[model samples]
Target: MNIFPKAQFLILLSEDLFSHPQETMNKVFQFLELAAYLSEEYLP
Candidate 1:
């Protein structure tokens, strides 16, 4: 199976994500266009 070009993705390290959840999630929400539905305390 070939998965490229057609599929978009982002790779983040566990350490980086855990160390900077808010920043990381912001990027994710923006990428998925769900920033409007994101809440500050949602992940907490």
Candidate 2:
């Protein structure tokens, strides 16, 4: 699966996300090549 240089496929679990919100989000952000600008205060 070489669509692009950054192309990727990720499978996340509900239990893992609920148990480790920050870690899970970090993985998502890193995969998307995004900056972690939204802090805990910005979340609902």
Candidate 3:
């Protein structure tokens, strides 16, 4: 039996997120449909 889902999985590395916080968060927010809640402080 498979433990993890094949189609709805996302792998995010800490180093990448730290290096590109704004860009990474933008993608995450968009994926979660929370872009409308994002504030201007999120951008650099």
Candidate 4:
């Protein structure tokens, strides 16, 4: 959506995992939550 493919973004995350697990996991969940929210068309 931001000129970057989600697939590529995920690959980048995987590459950084060893260096930053806590931060990456937090962000990964955030992204997952956002995806779920968007799919549900959340309004809150």
Candidate 5:
């Protein structure tokens, strides 16, 4: 059996970031196993 786990990777599109900043940040938080803690007002 393999002892090491696979690494995780997340890809963010520039268009999506510009179009949907909040959602994009949510995806990032989810990827890192963190709660959706960022709000729209905090995004650029």
Candidate 6:
């Protein structure tokens, strides 16, 4: 299975929602953090 590019996906999926600076950055960073943690959990 493949996950593709989450960052790009998130960006495209959230372009309009990210019009505000703080909220957009906050949400993106939060998703990044979660993605990192999930990656770590699946690491070999």
All predictions: root-mean-square deviation over Cα? 3.1, 3.6, 3.6, 11.0, 4.0, 11.8
Model 1 C-alpha lDDT per residue in residues 1-44, reported as the tens digit of each score: 27676337777677766787777777877878775445566343
Q: Give the higher-lDDT candidate: 1 or 2.
A: 2
TM-score per prediction, in order, is 0.60, 0.65, 0.56, 0.43, 0.68, 0.37
Count of backbone collisions within predicted model 2: 0
Residue-by-residue lDDT tens digits, candidate 4, 1-44? 78977665554455565576555555676766653222322222
Clashes of each: 0, 0, 0, 0, 0, 0
How far off is residue 6 in model 5, in Å? Answer: 7.0
Candidate lDDT (C-alpha), each: 0.67, 0.72, 0.66, 0.53, 0.79, 0.48
Model 4 Cα shift for residue 6 (angstroms): 5.7
Q: 1-44, model 3: which lDDT tens digit per residue?
A: 29876645656787777787777777777767775445556433
lDDT of 4: 0.53
Score candidate 4 by TM-score against the native.
0.43
Write the number of the candidate with greater TM-score, choosing between 2 and 5.
Answer: 5
Considering TM-score, where higher is better, how would the candidates rank from best to worst? 5, 2, 1, 3, 4, 6
Residues 1-44 of candidate 6: C-alpha lDDT, one tens digit per residue: 16775555655245444355455555666866753222212211
Tell me the RMSD of model 6 versus the true structure: 11.8
Q: Per-residue lDDT of 1-44 in model 2, one digit per residue for the tens? A: 46655356777897877777788888889888998655573231
| 2 versus 4: better TM-score goes to | 2
lDDT of 2: 0.72
Best by lDDT: 5
Model 6 gets an lDDT of 0.48
Residue 26 Cα positional deviation in candidate 5, in Å, after optimal superposition:
0.5
What pairs collide in candidate 6?
Answer: none
